[model samples]
Target: MSDEPERQIKALTGALMEVYETLRLICLHLPVPIQLPRGPEYDLNTLVPAVSRLIEIIGDQPMREDEQSLVWGSALNWTAAAKLYSRYLLTGGDFVSRLELELLIQTAGEGLIIYLDGPDSTTQE
Candidate 1:
């Protein structure tokens, strides 16, 4: 494998870490009553596995454009979903809105896991 995929993984993981830090800041400001879950939908649950697989893929081969895009898109989704959840929580939303936030978190997590098993894999695995 070339250094290109290594470089790409570094860049992608850096962007992902920025998103993670931003979300952590958001969490710090969330209402005291609204503790984020340590459950399956936790951001790290999405981030850790994805980053691990990305590292493996970088070590094994180059990334296709579609795979790169999916990873980047998932980072954005994680950011958007977290922000929306935080905003809704801070604004005193209803239970239905809370449920919607849960769905957003879950969906963003699903998006992040698209490459969890490697370059040719899907979330279905």
Candidate 2:
């Protein structure tokens, strides 16, 4: 039998790399220089949110390929969640990251991606 876990890891890594590259390029354009009071220990926590904000922008921005325009509804795609979870493992302490990962898995399994905004036309700060 095939090793399902290994397969999942591979797929998720591929997707993450793709999304990460795209976001990394966008991060280069962030107007504000990020400054942290602490050190590398907080890099993951601080950088992750910055990246999350970029993800939101990416979801709204359209990509053009082969004369087609494609937009991501959210970064929480099923395969992407695995990458995020693995990141959470490496990032160390963070309860919010853990919850987001679980919710991503649950929603992805249901064939849906959750956005940062509420259904009632409000946004989350």
Which candidate gets the maximum TM-score versus the true structure? Answer: 1
Range of the 10 consecutive residues with the lowest summed lDDT in candidate 1: 31-40
TM-score of each: 0.43, 0.33
lDDT score, residue 22, model 2? 42
Misplaced by over 4 Å in model 1 are 1-62, 123-125
Residue range 1-125, candidate 1, lDDT tens digits: 56854554354444445545443343334232112333324465555554344333432334455555554455456655445544654575555765565555555455445545455665355
Residue pairs that clash (backbone atoms under 3 angstroms), model 1? none
Error of 1 at 13 (Å): 22
In model 2, which regions exceed 4 Å deviation? 29-47, 53-125
Write down the TM-score for model 2.
0.33
Q: CA shift at 60, candidate 1, in angstroms?
A: 19
lDDT string, candidate 2, 10-118, tens digits:
5544544444344344334334322212332323445456544544454343332211111132333433565566676566526576566556655543321122121
At residue 5, what lDDT does model 1 achieve? 42
